[model samples]
Target: MGEKLIYMDHAATTYVKPQVVEAMLPFFTEKFGNASSIYTIGRESKKAIEESREKVSDAIGAQAREIFFTGSGTEADNWAIKGVAYANKSKGNHIITTNIEHHAVLHTCQYLENDGFEVTYLPVDENGLVTPQQVADAIKPNTILITIMFANNEIGTIQPIAEIGAIAKEKGIYFHTDAVQAIGNIAINVKDMNIDLMSMSAHKFYGPKGVGALYVRKGVKLVSFIHGGAQERGRRASTENIPAIVGFGKAIELATANLDEYNKKIMALRDRTIDEITKKIPFVKLNGHREKRLPGNVNLSFQFIEGESLLLMLDMKGIAASSGSACTSGSLDPSHVLLAIGLPHEIAHGSLRLTFGDENTDEDVNKLLEVLPVIVERLREMSPLYENVKRGNKNV
Candidate 1:
């Protein structure tokens, strides 16, 4: 082997587990059929879909009838926002969300704003947190929906979802959460949390891409996102993607079954890396809340260093990481999440996100530790900002 690829980008995507692949193989070849058809093969397809639905539902503590499969997490988010916006228009046009939400939620909210809805984008503190009091204060009588992410994709800040859920419930307003990043890494009980709707994706949890699910609680009115076949109970359309759905079911089943053990392993790696990186590097600051964050997330910002340049150097060494969320990585702008957490634009541009996964071992983390300080030192030497600060010419 040339070299193993040390991937620290689990928040972006994950490789399909062998078990998930095996579970999906039969659906693609032997059981190929249109789920809508009533023939023998069709019945098998329908059966698999229903089974997967139950698996996904039970994984998140939702009823089987409430889970609606979508093409991707983005689609699930879009449906949750637009469906509620249109159906509850007569009730209210105001929505509550945070500034650091994934673009899926932010962009959809923007689209709704153009259509005459009002949105309140709450700001986070230095550690990227919005208190339950802030959420309660933001609520208005005309606020129809409150969609906040269960965990942030960039800084891995775990929101007080249960607290906010209670606030929304007390106000009788609908609540939705984009739990895509939190699903496999954290345990969730939607019923206990009082969440009315939630979004999830399989690729974030060692399953195939292009498959996602949205949870809409019973008695909640949501207009159809797609009008076509009777699939997804007419809430969503398009023929079922049986193979991917099977993979999704298997992935969630395995992930949730041993979530605590998985978290222990990855959290060890994450904390060790943080300890080493911060202790060894000067002028490096940790991002997100120290104790109340995801198990496998370590975000940092090195003064005078650019994140994209560091990522390029890391890539050449057979390591994969991220500057921010994969959805907004293409943009030259600094992360909105970083800004919302009180980072200046220049400091935000220097952010580095290293997220862990099941496949990452201690050796991978060690390799990163070995190479990271050298890279940061080399980059800092070339930076005029560092030179000026070194000579006592300027203050940080």
Candidate 2:
């Protein structure tokens, strides 16, 4: 194994920042009081929760009252889709979304379909983009919601969110985006974008895991998700996870404050890695938009090699990366996002996703470039498909 570890899977989740940890430590022990209580320690906890809410709202151009904390991005997504569906079912039963959304969105939509909701799973172009026109055209009179992801977790393709949001607004439909992968990476204004609902995860942005938030625009009709307490302004119920919430707030504040510098540094490393890998490796295909992708995302497919093999090989070389979303890593199927963008089953099965972050340096990129080509070459040499092609077997 290589002496140093190179972590390049920020799209899955991020390590909690030290500053966020410091802010959260007090809530865990020193101020270990239930936020719902009315006593002194409880009041302090409540105050901390509200302050964190304000920080989250400020980071995303939302009103503090709009942010409701949840257990995870998956929970937020489930709530957003189901809440809007049930609340507005009398008016509409149709929801439109792209085919390449994360399983958090896709599976929720599927579950809604089982509950008698109609969904239009729109297809994306080869570059994994859904146009505003596709959204505008898919709208039916009964279309209650349009839920698309802000950015793809696998291929890292950013959607035309503003345009789609505007179309939904003009059509008088609610819009929701799973911004779990986009919260800290992209600048977003829910009001300006006409987004009625959005979901975010703390772990995606250097905050604690198991805590997330849903932004519900004022006056949007959404039924309560959890039903036990008066917490989250009666929208979501449960005792609040104050420590993680505080960490989330601190992390978002820091991330948005340093967004520009973070992008610049990470993008340089990403581009260099992409350029070097493609230049050095054979039969490589770059996934997602060449330009309109997340700054630190580098997705590629090496022909005649399995993505799992590549990932394991890279791991042995001290590079921690992913074949696709970490949530689906255990699955043997090819990435749905790659297939949505027209990649064949074989090529899609060979996809690799390496997302950069603030801590990744040029040395990390150099090490990857040096080790990756050798790994791919070695893997392909063992591949019968490449051997067949080498022997002029065109049918392969």
Candidate 3:
């Protein structure tokens, strides 16, 4: 057995980088002060928070004042959707979003629907790409907000946010994006995209987990999500999590500063892994848009095998990965994203999400390639459907 554990779940969350951890230590101890206080310690804390705000703003090409901190990406998503909807209900009642959004966005939209707000869930193409025309066509006279994710969490498909934003801007509708998975991976300019609001989680990009930010464009009106102290310009209120905020800022700075290099390296490793797995494995289907997907994402389905079984085998081999399967959820329903992309329930049941990250290497890819086919083969041998197919009984 291999002594090292191979972690490839970056999309879920990243481990904190050393520098970011170092940047946070002081605030956690000696410099610990409530940012809302007026004392010298409080001023120091306030300064750190403001500096972090500026760093986050600079990373995304937004003004510092436009950034509001939240507890997590889910909070940011909830806040953005509900905040805009409540604040602008008089303007309109319809909201537009895609079918492949994370549960945060999807559930929030459902909540809004219960509140009598109309929402249009747009469908994606076979490649998991939502077209600009689809978005434009979905817009109604009552449409007040367009919320889309910058990238798909499971499939890693990058949406046409700039185009979507342009469409929303043309119609004078508010455009927001859940960019939690994309902030460190892609270039973002709020003004150029005409995005009214965006949500990002610090943990997704090597920062602390409890701190995130929501970008509300200048002049955009949104109701407060957290109501208490006068922190975060009264948008979100609580004593700021200063250490986590500092860590978040440092993480963003490091990620953006080395973006190009990181992309090149990670993409190379990812592509190598994908190519090797696909070429060597039989009956494998790659999900999502090949060209427009995230650099480190490789989602695939192996026919006639269960994803949970494969995940268990990988775990035994010290490889950490994710699988989307009905059995895993103790439900008969397959992954909504996979099914939406035209995969049959059986195929969707076998889906695996192998996301690469900073620590993955060519050796890790090769190790996965070496072990995965054997596991698939072993699993398939026990699968009745696979056995039937092998005996030339396609109907099974």
Off by over 4 Å in 3: 324-333, 393-396
For each candidate, the alpha-carbon lDDT, in order, equals 0.94, 0.92, 0.90
Worst 10 residues of 2 by lDDT: 387-396
Give a tens-digit lDDT track for model 1, residues 210-325.
99999999998899888888998878888999999989999999999999899999999999999999999889889999988999999999889899999998988889999999
Cα misplacement distance, residue 10 of candidate 1 (Å): 0.5
Alpha-carbon error at 212 in model 3, in Å?
0.8
> How many clashes (backbone N, Cα, C below 3 Å) per candidate?
0, 0, 0
For model 3, residues 1-396, the per-residue Cα lDDT tens digits are: 765899987887789999999999999889988887889988999999999999999999999999988899889999999999999999899999998888889999999999999999999998899999999999899999999999888889999999999999999999999999899999899999989999999998999999899999999878999889888887788888899999989999998998989999989987887888889987898999988988888899999988889988999988888874211345546778898899998999898898888989989988898899999999999988888787895645
Residues 187-211 of candidate 2 have per-residue lDDT tens digits of 9999889999999999998999999
TM-score of each: 0.98, 0.98, 0.97
Q: Report the C-alpha displacement of residue 201, candidate 3, in angstroms.
A: 0.4
Error of 3 at 55 (Å): 0.5
RMSD of each: 1.2, 1.2, 1.9
